[model samples]
Target: MLLLLPTLIGLVVAASIPPSIPHETLEVIPDGWKLHSTAEDSQTIALQISILHHHTDYLDIAHDVSNPESANYGNYLGAEELEASLPEYQRSAAEVVSWLNNHAISKTTLDGDWLHFETTVGQAKELLGADFMYYQHGSDDPVLRTRKYDIPIHLRDAIDFIYPTTHFMRPKWPAKMHLLPRQHIPTGPVTCATSICPKNLTAKYNITHVPADSNSGSQLGIGGFLEQYPDHKVVQQFLKDYGLRHHDKPYKYKVTLINGGKDPNIPAKSGAEALLDVEYGMAIADSLPVTYFSTGGRPARTPSQPGNKVVPRNESGNEPWIAFLQHILKMKSPPQVLSLSYTDDELDVPLPYARKVCSLCAQLAARGVSVIVASGDGGSAGTTTKDCKGPNGKLRFIPTFPASCPWVTTVGATNDYGVAHYSSGGFSNYFARPKWQDKAVSGYRTLLNGSHMAWYNKTGRAYPDVALAGSGYLTAGGGATYQQKGTSASTPVFAAMVALLNDKRLRAGKPVLGFLNPLLYKNEGMFRDVTEGDTDGCEVGSEVEVGFGASKGWDAASGLGEPDFAKLLKVLT
Candidate 1:
């Protein structure tokens, strides 16, 4: 009777089990890879698992808060309120922790929606149901990865994705500066100087005189990455050289380092990208308080490292972009306006990873933070490198990330208020067109009349939201002055403008311009429409074809055009 009862219990347990189904293939090990016998069992691996939760309600609430016409427009959620609202998020986090604990994985920590822990390669392989091996791309260093991964069916709903998993993203600093000849420098500042000084440009754009009471509580920030450090001395000299200092006082900004981020005072380690971003942002928005975020993390191995590894590599072993955004999201008092000059080609990033990043941007926007990103400098052809080439060897049109995200304002480049030829502009392949820009994009598509239509995704999100000067601006770095060009220059300029606008709104007892698309699209009169020049590159023949052009209305090359400060103030206030 005891043996029969045991057999009956075993049969019931076996009958309750469900068949396994195929889930997402997190990674695919490249062909011709050799396994590391020693690494398989002995090596310890770290995994940063991202849990999924129902964000639909939160997104809806955010959208309402962002929409100016809505009743809840200015009612943004605080960090505590946000956490409390997402019961599903809390539940998912607890479930993931419990599951890990049940598996005897004790080293785990939870932050918002991410669960981080370390485990052995053997345990990871068994846990994730995947094989791990070593593979090298070309002459690059070898990496340890798996071709595919599987999760238990029950846990799939709770997991969104994991990083350092399958996706590889390389965010680039978009500043490309050329050293100006000594003869080109003016002995004294001239009205409408050819060098395009920040003062002259600000005056031209009608942002010359900000009210004394403005910018009282408004704050602006710039994102720094890849060990790039902005020196205070460089910024001061730049302000002095251009004669834009405040009563002989050197311009100053607070540098906040995150995740081992460094701001070494050594001039040799300082970069032009950092200098230009700080100079333009501070110089333009002279009245506002500014913060420079020095975001540090391990260098991504996909685009290859810059030779030597001086900084601690893989300290967190997390992707820099994700880490940077996550850090910002958790901030209790993030800057109202944040400018980022970094970008990467859209296709280089995996779809799930890109979507997750974009969603994070949405979260930031919902909290009334206006995030600005440089579109790209690659024109319609994408980055001018071998990596952008498709498998067919044809030069493909690659859109850029963060810029391609519809939640944030994407800034393009122009020369002398005209669309710059190299200013990257196109529709996105990953994101669809949002309702705000439908009329404008539809008109632009009609103008194209199917010209180069086959090369791009027409139904995708189009950029940029606006354009600004991006050519031949003087920037100081390494104790020398250089002329910088690219959408990087344009981004900080626009970000400064938005920062000033936010200041005005805050002073007027109004909400900061959150998720600027709806407001920008609705208020066309606030900007000067650029109707000249064309963005042409990705040379197929001897002649460069025009990819997109500036038009009377919104066009991909120049979007709504440069900002008109007076008009913007009137509309916003």
Candidate 2:
């Protein structure tokens, strides 16, 4: 009966996982638990605290919903400033963090808040310190619906432990990130992909994908996101021209088609995102050089009458999504890095689904898989283009999804100077910090002014621990590789780097640097901090703004800064 425990644990872990994320074997649960407190109280229930809960977007920047720019920006806005910006309930987040640190809580190690998991139920009056606003969980239990603390939580287990297997942008010493012209297309010929790759010289290594963009038709591209952006048509053509095809290449590449938002069982209107993802899959696949593996079914789309045929179901927060992707990649073994350009905004105390996915991402990282993600195109305000015909016909400035998932390496976009504009940033509505941001400062400089805080009240690190090129001149495929912009474009670039690192790691036989947070934060030399500038506008429009300045350390806009590909390559290699 005791030996059967491992099997039971695996089954529970698998059943609890979100559909899109992967599930690994379970680690042993510790024999005992510790009791910690924030030492504060309020009307709302505050069980646990964290910034950008899960995914690491910058924390909320507003003091009130009425003011988008009200809250202070630099360095968590300082203690005095934070005190003024938040209500009593919100300010408790700082106290929670302060108490944990004061008590010497091991942030990323298995000893304390790290690698911790729990499920509790009670009223806001029963949990941590405050009675946070009653956020609905679509659950029947009054506790979950009103003030129940059915919190399914986990934390970094080591003072410098990795997020199991998640990651994205972490620069190297002498970090200096830059971009080049449209280099290759999704289906072009294969011939020395590394040749003339920009940001490759004067340091380590650099990586990227082939047939950069996807498309097969002239009128519309495969993916909804690509077609939505300008210059997509040109990118389609570039993929046709430069990218090497599997037939044209000597090396082999595998593919996995993910319709994470699929929901035929639901209405199209209900699953519109799934519909959009269908096209997204085809578009992405068409632009690539390898064959996309599938579950023997076409990409799922939300049916109408209820189906937003153009969109699919919203599975942006599923764990099996990433897990399945990894399972499909099956590179004889897991790669050192995996890049995913997905995100979500609803993570603070993740929905049942969010918890499952977070666990999967964490497990993968523990086994050594670097997950890179896109912060978003909304800039610091987080713009969301929702299908508003039913409730919101117009797009709103809401946080994006997936990118908000804490376990994956959340990435934001940046311009040359390293400041940010509209590139999305803020705290999570669902998850919490998973260790990794902890690092000692080197003799380097950056834009941000203070150390990152781990808490939930007020605002927390919503996203963008690191940044990359997503500006004026980058390439993609409409049918071939061409140039375009947006955090979308930026996402793949980082993914490619992770891939390159994987290529190197697999050759070395080292644990593929599983769960990269600790290493990333501890290794400040891998990145070049961007302490100036900010984005303005959407990817299609210019609204966010960034000043042209270069400083040291994290900045309000650019966070820890951008990548220095040269340094990045050296470190990874």
Candidate 3:
């Protein structure tokens, strides 16, 4: 009877006799969420159900093609080719749909591997045997979720995991910026020591190659979330004010909206993160077509009273990462290079949800897309360490997710001199160390020699694969110029450089660089090693001034080192 049941979501379970329905727990709510009260039975709720794939060989296949040393290097797959490889996609969807239909969930929209449906709170609770309750975090609006959810043992094989059930992570954009008095834009070479701009990045990294025309099949993508619309008019003004040229082409960029994402043309309503990303990315990768992916996450709340101010809503949708990646993966020819500046604490995200996001990244890698992410803004602990303590009341350092996912290339921050103190870097608490980084991480591991054993996971995946200038950036946003700092600046800077390299590769009849970790680890000499500065925070209990320090090799502070564009292009192309 036990052998008849299959393994599901990394859990082993046994089927019960026909008289009883064997309920298997799927995912449990993460820590730091306070249960307020039971949700209203009549309240409507939306859920996304992840279906299990019959074959997952694409994970390894993604690695093989991404590795420069492999014979299948750059041999990528398309959206249809990759989906067809999953043998049981249709069968699994059929089973899951039938199960949902049996529960009276007839209205569902199936998109690839995800099945989306809306149901009443009462029906959701009765359908999945879950206790739906309102959980709140600090002063944030309370969200309706369950402590844990279970499914009938028979349907375990058809489902991977249900999202927004046990996951409580809300993505945070980590760029810190301040508005400055309007000043004259310099026409000559901008001083690199004072601020980071197009001239500074191009000259410092030896980035001399011109990006081909937009029709050359080379494009860069920036992720816009939480209504972060990139104002095109602002970017156009930035190009003109800075005296920047777009390879003799007009300054333009495209936007793709997902899940009702907004794209307001008003500069005052623009998000600083989105503006900085587009402004600098276009400036650096001049002439390359840029696509801003505005993904919707939280919906605007309706006023409880007609004349009252807008109050926060208690309901939330899927994580923006899920919606953004799902949209990109479905495209026939997605952008060759993508930069995302949003992140969440690893512990705040459930293990299954994190893994699901990682798998989506892997699929993008298989399709020959560079998935670049910010390591985070807070060093070790994340954003700020004020009253920082693990949910278990333990003095442990918190790691960042997606950055810790191992599948994507995570970049940290550096300054004019060395590693930025706030550049987030650390080992993952969820994923294990990957083989590609074994040699690189060993050098830093030996430097520690069993120190900070109680702080973070020793055998976990480490991040900030590489670091670049992130501080003191003169960014244009919201009809004003500002000085911004954070890994948010570093992420797009690095991504633009990669997009330029992709342009070179595309001209030479080669595929775009995808999954850069393996290639970067293999060629450590392409970066300038930085052995200065240390990460901030993680001061727990009486352990004052606790954090990882920069070392000779790839310590968390600045992984490998800052990019040397000349060396990278010389070796890669």
Candidate 4:
């Protein structure tokens, strides 16, 4: 699922940059705080973390998760696609650290107390030499059955620590236009998207709606799909069942469990995963001071958006959403963070909408709103879709759209180690790296018992303007707890961080992070550089395709390791 929406706005003069990190700021982790960790064998490693900015007051922790029922479920689709061949044998993630102490791939020293992995066989064994395990991707599930890699012993030998990246910040949800739930959608947030006439660039566009769904969102008939298809694996396992659901938004989703039916082949109804993205991305949107927008998801059934925001193309060439944006911009101030998580990856990247979408985002960024877009999930990023179908008859080299649109702050996915494997990061046949790629803002995975490599020193070029964790482990969704993985999980986590930073900047009275590219590019050490592992969609076994990974300065794969958001605030503030 991708995020897509439209808009514009006007506002007061950009706020002034805040004063030199308030007295309290400079006083805490004075200037550069040097920290070090030691390996079991007694080797000391240095880690430089500049205490850029720290704020615990309004730590707007907005990321995604949960249904209206679950506790603190924001928008992380909880269900993870398990490494179907995960190494059953378990080992303390700490043991894996001991092995890395002897043989390490990255500059970051390993500490068993934190988290670590030890590869026991295959490529990792061959590369790092026995005792480590490699994690592979979901689609690569079939390869594990073979002795392709000795993954179990290494998995058992490792002890790992993973902190939940997102949590409900609080009950305060943010949005430009509030919405009155129509039928299926719960009543809470609102979108003033009336079927009024278009007013902006959208004024030139036109679309139609299914007659049965004249009010696709206002009526229950159109929303019945939610109830009827709870059994559908994609929905049950990923959307309704996944992530941390808050108590307020529970009705937004009904966790009724479904069956594949007595017959294993029974098919269900029409549906999509845009909401999962909305919830996740929404958290990010809320976190930031910027206004979030999307084209609703996919090519929203004609005029309705994925989030069901209505589009009145006939009206001023813009829909209510766009108009609302303009109205907000006309106010005393406009939002600084704008996010669109929808994409038409199956559609052409240069389509009229793609151009419009990217152009709009570019317009916002120019005005100071840092636009964030998901690089994409479909491996090819829309370079190969349409006629390109796989053995399963599904689009084979299908590309994710919009992310290919260079104007927005595009982000790709990465694993815990900052590797660009999974279906996340990659170059777009349709777009080029934007200036942002060189700057701040932007944003893979494992397996080998069905385990494997993510980002390794320039092993591949698929990026993530930055990186965050998007691999396996655990989550809760549908009606039960399960596991899942994908770039889908990474986007929101990044959004939340953006939100936290935005809050800090706003409180300090800074020009809301406009075009973050320049600032991010100006600073380097603020981030912990990622420098290992290789993304496999492009090919790995072939020695000819090596040297792709993260490294000193900027390399693809993992743009920059997970951000030290607080430190980043100090630099920017």
**For this target, which candidate reaches the highest TM-score against the unseen true structure?**
3
Local accuracy of candidate 1 as per-residue lDDT tens digits, 1-573: 887998999999767543334455633332223443234455566678878866566677778888889989878877666656653676777777777776689878887777888776688776777665544444433444665676657777888876655544455777787886544333344422556778777777888446424346778899998778888876777666674545434458899888778889677888888888988898877757889999876522322223523333334356667777777777898888889998887876667778878877877777788899998888876654523344244455678787899888999988864899888888898999999899999998898887776667899999999998899888766645688899998898889888888887788788788778888999989889989888865565565555788888899889988888878877876
Candidate 1 local distance difference test against the native: 0.75
Best by lDDT: 3
For residues 1-573, write the lDDT of model 3, one tens digit per residue.
667445552253222211224333423344545776566788777888888776788887898899898999999999888786554676888877887787789988888888888888899887777887777666555666776677766667778888767667767888888666775544443533567777778888888775455667888999998777778777787777653563355678999888767788797888889988998888888888899998876622223323433433323455678888988988999998999998878877777778889999999999999998998888877753533466565667778878898888999998867899888889988899999899989889899898877888888999889998988888776545688999999999899889988888888899889888899999999999989888886664566645678889888889999999999989988
- Candidates in descending TM-score order: 3, 1, 2, 4
Give candidate 1 regions above 4 Å deviation: 1-23, 26-41, 102-104, 131-143, 181-192, 211-215, 243-245, 248-250, 299-316, 384-396, 537-546
Pitting candidate 3 against candidate 4, the one with the higher TM-score is 3
Better of 1 and 4 by TM-score: 1
Cα lDDT for residue 7, candidate 4: 20
lDDT to native, each model: 0.75, 0.36, 0.79, 0.33
Off by over 4 Å in 2: 1-253, 257-336, 347-350, 385-400, 438-462, 473-482, 535-551
When summed lDDT is taken over every stretch of 10 residues in candidate 1, the lowest stretch is 299-308
lDDT per residue (tens digit) for residues 182-216 in model 4? 33321322211331111110121111111111111
Tens digit per residue, CA lDDT, model 2, 1-573: 999999999999778642321211112211111111121222211122222233221123311211213332111222233334322332333433443443334342121122321212222223222222212112211111222221213222111111211111111111112434444443443421433113321122233323333221111111112112223234234334332233242222333344332212222122122222222222333333322222111112222212123322232112234335434223333433555444434422124445545554554443345566667665533443322111122222334456666666667777655554647665554555433442322212122333222211123334566776655422333222223345554554555554444444445553244344444665567787676664442222443222212346643345466666556657755
How does candidate 1 fare on TM-score? 0.87
Q: Decide which is better by TM-score, 2 or 4.
A: 2
Give the winner by TM-score: 1 or 2.
Answer: 1
On the 0 to 100 scale, the lDDT of residue 41 in model 4 is: 21
> What overall lDDT, based on C-alpha atoms, would model 4 receive against the true structure?
0.33
Supply the global lDDT for candidate 3.
0.79
**Count of steric clashes across candidates, in order:** 3, 167, 0, 122
